[model samples]
Target: MSFREMTITLDDVLAFLHLPMGGRFYTPGYATRAEAAQTCALLLGGSASDYALKFDHVKTIGLRFGFLQELYTKALRDRRYGPATQMWLVHVVGSMLFACKSGGWYTTVHWISIVEHLDQVLEYAWGAIALPTLYDALGHASQRKTKQMCYYTSLLLAWVFEHFPPTIIQRMEVPDYTEDQPRACRRRESRTGHPELMERQVIFDEMTAEDVIWTPYEEHRDRSSAAVSVDGAYADYEPYLIPEGVPATIEGEVVGNYLDWYTTVSHSVYHPG
Candidate 1:
């Protein structure tokens, strides 16, 4: 059986998830424990020592989602509205969008700095960060002994469900989808009785171009019209589109070589055949 190259693109991310793809790139630099504690105290109104105790470990200055939730609750109870909202944002961004593989709970302290000034939270390129993160996680998960992965996996799942035939997916009906809802919201994957690994591989091996849904969302385009509007709010992501045989370049250097690289790379799964 011949193989076909497939990928999740910025267009898929925008159409399915409706994440913000504009503003300054998200570059959360590393933070030492002292710096993390200081930021936590200033933003969440806690003592430095108390904040220090929330770190995930001695070497990594990271905080758990549980700790962030506690701080969020405390800020709300104390009527510190600003801190509460910041804490909530941190928790959501960390746990939902940029989660790490550390037991699926810890997030680096560097994210706290992003929310340091509330006015600038919306300025970061969250979708840009999320897509790369998902790509990284996928690469890692493809490696041997890699037992787990974290990040916005919903994007990958949604892209697959949208592009592939429904025979491979167990989707539930979404009755009340609206213009404001993300395309992902219209389909739900059933939880029970999924196919085993080899069964899934057989199904994939049997797939042909005719089985693919090139434009599965065409019927829903009218409902999703508002969700896909860029309208000066998002960054110009169109220039990065990866059309067939076209190279993506930066400073006149081709970066789309990854397409070739991925085709040749060995992608062994964690389990033995």
Candidate 2:
């Protein structure tokens, strides 16, 4: 069997999700239970004890999505619009953008710290963090005995539906495209049913270069003529661009050893050419 390299580029994230590709890099730091509880109380105006209880696990000093939702609802009832909105954004970032592997409902308090100052929230390089988090989830899911996966799965699914043939996906009717909406909003997964595991394996085994849609966004590209600019504060993510040939690697013994190990286990399933 031949092999083909399939990658989801930074461009795909920018175009498909319209998430900011440039901003201050978000690096999560360690926070103790006291610190996390303080953050929740100061920003979200809740009892420190109640917030402390949410940190059931020491490793994941985070709150549940259900807890956040309850806070949001309570805030709305009390007419505390500002805190309510902040709670909502916190829930979105934690549950959707930077979800933890613990489950879909649990999210770390790190996002609460980030969302504390709403005015500066846009200054975060969300796309940078999100892509890598998804990659991490995919890596974990690929391991033996890993039954479930988390993180922003919608991005991965959208990438697959856009690049793969409909025969393999059995996609539903797509919605009309609009410049205001992200590309991901238009596509939906099959609602009828899915093929069995063996059937899917056969479909993948038979996949060829002709079966893949190399450039599904050609029309959208033409329509989006206006160029978007990146701020100078953010790292120029030019390295994410597809290279001409075998990509350059960082010169280091560790990297070299990893590359050797990866090459032995990794096998391509399709050849584009």
lDDT of 2 by residue, 205-234 (tens): 787767777766666655654213333323
Candidate 1 local lDDT, 56-144, one digit each (tens) = 45236667777788888888889989989988988888776666656547776676678878898888877667788788779888777
In model 2, which regions exceed 4 Å deviation? Answer: 57-59, 100-104, 225-263, 268-273
Worst 10 residues of 1 by lDDT: 263-272
In candidate 1, position 140 carries an lDDT of 87
- Each candidate structure's TM-score, on Cα atoms with residue i matched to residue i, is 0.77, 0.77
What is the model-wide C-alpha lDDT for candidate 2? 0.73
* The best candidate in terms of TM-score: 1
TM-score of candidate 1 on Cα atoms, chains taken together: 0.77
Give candidates' CA RMSD values in order. Answer: 5.2, 5.7
Candidate with the greatest lDDT versus the true structure: 2
Question: Could you tell me how far off, in angstroms, the CA of residue 40 lies in candidate 2 after the best superposition?
Answer: 2.6
Error in Å for residue 176 of model 1:
1.6
